[model samples]
Target: MQRKAPARGFEQAEFQARTQKAQALMAQQGLEGLLLMTEPDVRYFSGFHTLFWQSPTRPWFLFIPASGKPVAVIPEIGAALMRQTWIEDIRSWSAPAPQDDGISLLHELLAPLARRGARLGILKGHETSLRMPLGDWERLVRALPGLQLTDATGLIQGLRMVKSAAEIEKLAHICTIGSATFDQVPKQISQGMPLEEVFRAFRREALAQGADDTPYLVGGAGPGGYADVISPPSRRPLQAGDILMLDTGATWDGYFCDFDRNFAIETADDAARRAYDVLWRATEAGLAAAQPGNSCQDLFQAMQGVIAELDDQSGDIGRLGHGLGMQLTEQPSHADFDCTRLQEGMVLTLEPSLGYGDGLIMVHEENIVIRADGAELLTRRAPPELPVI
Candidate 1:
């Protein structure tokens, strides 16, 4: 059944609370302001949502001062839309202006902080970028001599890691749509169909089932198992003994639901069935370990312990799963090296994969949110045993 979509975009209060949270963290870190350039960061604080970001022709910027609402310094084309958002101070410039591209406006907005040599924050850590021309970045740095630009990856990402009640509602809605789309797979695919057509069928089904978009869809098929998880679908057709998997990142509003379902094309080998059971049980272990007090390291160990019963090497896929939200995969990955603690309202994915029988592999994934009580599943659970079409 089709679920009702959540209300589009957040209210002004939601953006205000987000800004206030970042401002409080900025205070603790001694940051006078945050300079945001990425699409996600700008939208998080300003609610300035647009597909205009698709073009790199114009760069956008959002500045969160020590007080008040966010300021948008962007191209003139976006001004009217920016005005519609909660932001009051919208500065615009005509663009492809490699000559001046909002640098003058940014300097004007931040010059006061520059004079005092006050510390400013921007993301410069893993999974983040400047999202602007390198030459322009140098010009802005040279223009503002005393402003100390520090990395705000931790401060910014920390706030985003946890979900608000309003945000959780959007995520849950999309997960339901994605789950409904997956449920149609058995009826939509067949043995003679090419893998590319299968991929197309999924995108169509996801959109029809009320997903805003199915931006991410990937997986593989082989006699017993697939080669890799991230490969694009080839023209190869499915065979009776093939095992197929489809993982998707489907969106509703601006939130995403990420998970996958595995199906046996006609029949399965004993080795394939056993691998599925091990991965299913491993995901169960991960769910049990996803509590408020546990760290990502603890979650990794819980899942890894079960996977070890099969592939002691764990198939070398690196991290088991990661935090999920605005982007398909966010920070606080489930891995031994990461010790980020689980907190209530944090959404995550439990993914387990193992290698068996002459270089073949199988992967399983489920989405859940960490809760005070424990982990709450977001996606419908896959069958305990692999289903044969």
Candidate 2:
């Protein structure tokens, strides 16, 4: 007989905690149930990440009622994978060909609660099920015309904002893999190496170090080139005076770690060296603002203050940092305009960029988790100044 495959990294306690939090939110919103269909949210609540998402022919539906255990109404192809986890109750239908594949399954699972006058909470913005016709969802709503449907994305966003202990460990492991990969890039990026060669070398190193894939990888090299935010590496060979920006990250298991450092090829230029120091200070200022009870706006302001003090041209076109979770870039990005509060257990990236002159810009980014004391650095490596060649 063949042996069963081992379970993925899963913690029952974490699931229960999340469920309890959701239940509280449901009570506050007066929602009878929440209908989660987004891939990340589904995997988060159900602890199942199946490859069946590639088939747009069918959508996976997970119904988390205000009370009791959650039930997943998924395609038959994904049912087996769901069984591998602690989620025992699952209902599935065949496919597009079946008379009533996903539509029928969803109605059957929700009909009883709808009859009980249950209000359905949906993340309409991210719901892929509504893509085609939404005819099935409409029919189900009509079946129980009294049932109410409202947006419940806030409940999910709240739970995900606070990282659990297990999640932090996974994120830390991801950072370790990323840092290890970056540590080796110096040897490969010499004065004469092509930009593509540097890019390929980093990709290979990251994968070999256990990264499943990279979500972000864009960098460039030029004596005074930094015009575009993210462009493909060019065929031009890296020269001694080139200032290169390598901002990249890779996913390990499922968590993602992002870190970017500026490097000066072979010979260090005065402008590049000064830009690096300013960005380094700005990054540190941003990290310093990440503490319990602080506002995200304050964090960006801290970096903004440093950048403005250094160069009048410094401005934040993007968020100072964003919350990182299962799907890499999530929420809580520290925008100079946002008013969100900083809380403990939140993992964010402290990256502040400064653009000056034509094709001259500097950026330094790192990851950290908010703690009671202060910011806890996840990516422990020091920022690079010049290429090690």
Candidate 3:
């Protein structure tokens, strides 16, 4: 299916801004060149997409250096798409035939840098699996003997954590789609409707409203309704007394909007309402901790405090929110493992859900920016306790 061109927005300008932003990182890391093989990083630097990622048969990489123009090593079939991107230098290779070696083509792309000591940085290198086989790595090593290789994950993540103005606008537009689709969910949902059908309805509605991609959507409708944490939407039927929780996100122009709300099929039960109230309170605490100059851990701690107060002993995910921008999930995660401070340009989601015998309730909300005063709420309306239907 032909994807509708992204609406007139800030994506074009944002792409340029991101490239310039990465230039400084490359210089700072002392990297002669950086190779981007993963989806998020590839999409971040180059506005391109491909499903060829499923196989290691032909690996694609984007090579960027501090001082010069970037180059793309892609399959010949995708050469046209690569040319369509802003990056000017791209090399195409024919499929690996018995006569032609794929590694030689990759080395040919990187051969010029052999004299520069071939100090290359690979992002998400340790995490590559079948798509980037060991043979490819060995070929790169053998192709450039004595090359100094390093992990570029941190350098890449740092650049991505901060959102440019164009990025913020794109994300806000995605949020608009999510809010509009959510508003329609209550109207479309009904008792006895299968949960799977309801979920599909939301997906169709989101695409109709101009969603370029669906990044995250996991929810369910069971006897007592769905769980707190996002589980995949299932075939469970929506009983008259059951509650429905649909937490989903739509990615547009490389930006994402993650928002979820709980819907009561008929009447709001006392147990469900009470659980929702606690989750809402936790979400408020998370928002309060999102001020500029605050640590990401602080925001997570605030949410944890709420979960600790609950008498029930359900295991909490221990993180209040995560940064949302070009990728559905980005850096500065609100967890003990991360210590990055909040900045004015950062956008984050505050989703704190509690699961107990009282029935699961999710209070998912999101905010963008750490303003001079405080944080800005990106989501339209707060999640409802019950469906208005």
Which candidate's lDDT is highest?
Answer: 1
For residue 15, what is the lDDT in candidate 2?
81
TM-score of each model, paired residue for residue: 0.98, 0.90, 0.88
Candidate 2: segments with Cα more than 4 A from true spot? 1-8, 51-55, 97-101, 124-144, 310-315, 384-388
Estimate, for each residue in 124-153, the C-alpha lDDT of model 3 and write its tens digit: 632233245566677667868757787887
* Best-to-worst lDDT order: 1, 2, 3
lDDT of 3 at 263: 75
State the TM-score for model 3: 0.88
Candidate 1 lDDT, 193-288, residue by residue in tens: 999999999999999998889889999999998878887999999999999999999988778888988899999999899999999999999999
Clashing pairs in 1: none
Best by TM-score: 1
TM-score of decoy 2: 0.90
Tell me the lDDT of model 2 at 273.
Answer: 73
What overall lDDT goes with each candidate model? 0.91, 0.76, 0.71
Question: Which residue runs does candidate 1 get wrong by more than 4 Å?
Answer: 312-314
Angstrom error of the Cα, residue 308, model 2: value is 1.1
